[model samples]
Target: MELNQVYFWTNTIKDWKRLLQPDKYKHVILQSWQELVSRGVVCIYGFVIMPNHLHIVWEMLEPNGKEIPHASFNKFTSHTILADLKQHHPQVLPFFSVDDSDRLHRVWQRDPLAILMDGQEKVEQKIEYMHRNPLHERWNLVDSPENYRWSSAPFYETGLDEWGILTHYKDRF
Candidate 1:
């Protein structure tokens, strides 16, 4: 088996579903991300949630000297996100349901595209790329990178980390 120290992930929904068909849904997803980081389950390296998908750069930290397996974290986050979405708004029921195969609710794509990040350069580059996604030619939600609050752009711009979870990137910001 291959071993990697760091990984980049790109996970999407089935059929490119746009249940984040609106802005509030996206905000809720962002909030969930912040909550996870605050609890110390992971570090928020970078992230951008688009209308239909999201891009994130993060590190799953070991707990009490125990390594956090990537697959398990992803599954946990998937469940948490779905549960929160369902609890906050009953509107999500039309899109997702329990899967018979695994006997669990499946919402995200089966697997994510993971690229191991080994060096500082790769890490920095991925961070920049994630920030740029919200400004693609088709997307005009912001005039500048920092204007997008869904991302860590604001902290990078002002160094005023409204969310405590950004401590790891304070220097970079």
Candidate 2:
């Protein structure tokens, strides 16, 4: 399929607010995100990391000469996240069923919402909406989106980050 826009979303295995999960696992999710960008899978556009869920807007890249049915950044991260969660959070084991194929019902929800931004207007609008998500009606974590370190807002506003981060302020990483 031709590549353009992708919104990949996933939630915690049990909606357990592993939100307070130590910074240790922060890399688990972020590393997987960086890997995709590093491997030419997607040109990340925007993202937001809520306590139990995440939403990402990426411009899926179809590099020349690559052969694959599809390059789903979502699929790769889903597996990595499940693996990471299982390793770090085995307490939730009983909540899921493991199958012979190695797939487990570990995702809080099968899929949250992976809508494609089919046009420039929608893409721009989604980008803006995602940036302002932290400010939505009752979602008051901060007075401004840039105050949230887990989202791309700060990356754009202050250019401060710890590791591999591709944004308008990639130098922060």
Candidate 3:
């Protein structure tokens, strides 16, 4: 989680709910990354958005104001998702309700995993793992890694970053 260091990060939804099954919610994640990258807060190398969780290969370039980039990401996405649910998906709100004093609904589980990737090999390994995740038997989301739309696999395979949110890992490591 150190600034300017690459990390393999994973964050999951509360209770492993498939709240991200919808395309709209996934876009919420993409938008957050876009904002972070555009502002130079982070440099994303790879990522995948699964049904209930997400994995990212990124480096924190700098703090976003008073908050670290990832923390700001989680907070913003959580707030946006909560607002969307309250407005249009009220029925789904109960599933995320909690007794916490700070918030009524929790979108993301606490203590996300962030492992430092100290070398090119580790970064490549994590990127490969994330790219192939959609093809795993448990999910079977796509026939091939690059076929998954919500991942950086396609960018790696074709050198195309449709969303302008990714940086080539070689540029850093």
Candidate 4:
């Protein structure tokens, strides 16, 4: 959580719902990432947006305003996705329902996993793991990792920032 520390993070949707199967929801995630980068809160090195989860390797440049970048991302995307569900997919709203005192809807599970990328080897290993996630037997989202549009594999393979949200990890080294 310290500034400038690189982490390989994984965030799962509440109850692992497939809410992000739609491109619109994934776009919201991309927009949040772009905003954080633009605001100098984080520098994304690699990422993959799955149907129910997301994984990324990023450096926390600074806190997003008063909160950490991850908190800002969760809050923003949850609010946006909640609103979208309330309108077009009311039935889906209950999937995120929470009976706790704080709030009603919970888009993301609490306490996401973040492993410090302490060395270049660790960083490269995580980036590869993230890129190949879509090709996992359980998901099989793409025949090849590079074909998955929601991941940084294409960027790493072709040296193109199709999403315009990537900062090469080597640059920081």
Candidate 5:
């Protein structure tokens, strides 16, 4: 959440709804990252999008406007996902309805985990964990880390940025 510091960020869908199981929803997160990176507000070092949650190794370079980049990211992605669900999947929208006065539907759980990565060892540790997440027994999304399409593993393995949203962690740490 702090500027100029790398963080291992984890945000999950409300009540673990598996909202991101659809590729379109995952693209919503990806596009948000791409926009933030293009604007130089954040630099993504690593990431993985699971069925219900996502983990990112990223650094906030500057504020998006009056708010921190991560705040903007959460707000934007939430709104975007909400809009899509309202128009295309109204039946599924009720699952996210909340009793809060400020909002009706909440896509992301509040107060996501963001751990400061103060050293290369910590950063590397987080990235490797994220990369291996898809191969975990719970999800078994892919047989290998690099085979997972929604992660930075392939980028690190082949030096390719398919989403054009990653910065090699070494470039910063």
Candidate 6:
């Protein structure tokens, strides 16, 4: 939550819907991260965009206007994805609908899991976990971690920032 401090953050879609299974939705998440990075609000060290959730090891470089960078990301991506779904997949919108008074559609669940990374060991562990997520038997998204296009494994393994939003954890250390 504080500037320059690393955290392992996990955010899941409401009802665990596989909304991010589509490439377009995944890109929306990436674009949100890129926007925050461009505005100097966050520096992503590692990330994996899963079908229904996302994991990130990042530093909060600064606040996004009055709100924290994570809050801005949640708000921006939710609104954008919700709008897209409304226009193209209105039937799917009901799955994210809420009965409470806080707006209508809720893309992400409340209180995302954020574990503060106090040392390099913990950071490395989380980075490994994130990279291997897509390779898990349940997902089987890729044979190799680096093969997953939505993860930062390629950057760590081959020293390539294909997505342009990653800040090598070694560099940060």
lDDT of 4 by residue, 1-173 (tens): 67889999999999998999999999999999999988988999999999999999998898877898988999999999999999999998888999989999999998999999988899999999999999999999999989999999999999999878999889976
Off by over 4 Å in 1: 1-4, 21-23, 63-100, 168-173
Tell how far residue 23 is off in model 1, in angstroms: 4.1
- Count clashes in each candidate, considering only residues at least 3 apart in sequence or on different chains: 0, 0, 0, 0, 0, 0
* Candidate 2 clashes between residue pairs 3 or more apart in a chain or in different chains: none
Report the lDDT tens digits of candidate 6 across residue range 61-105. Answer: 888899999999999999999999999999999999998787988
TM-score (C-alpha) between model 6 and the true structure = 0.97
- My TM-score estimates for the predictions, one after another, are 0.72, 0.66, 0.98, 0.98, 0.98, 0.97
Instruction: Report the lDDT of model 3 for residue 132.
Output: 95
Local accuracy of candidate 1 as per-residue lDDT tens digits, 12-109: 76557776556765656666656666666666666777766777766666441343544544555566667777798668655666657874556677
* Superposed model 4: Cα runs more than 4 Å off: none
Candidate 3, residue 147: the lDDT equals 97
lDDT of 3 by residue, 82-167 (tens): 99999999999999999999888899999999999999999999999999999999999999999999999999999999888998
Off by over 4 Å in 6: none
Query: What local distance difference test score does each model get?
Result: 0.65, 0.58, 0.95, 0.93, 0.95, 0.93
Off by over 4 Å in 5: none
lDDT of 2 at 15: 54
Lowest summed lDDT over 10 consecutive residues: which window, candidate 4? Answer: 59-68
Q: Which candidate has the highest lDDT of all?
A: 3
Better by lDDT, candidate 5 or 4: 5
Task: Judge candidate 4 against the unseen true structure and give its global Cα lDDT, from 0 to 1.
Answer: 0.93
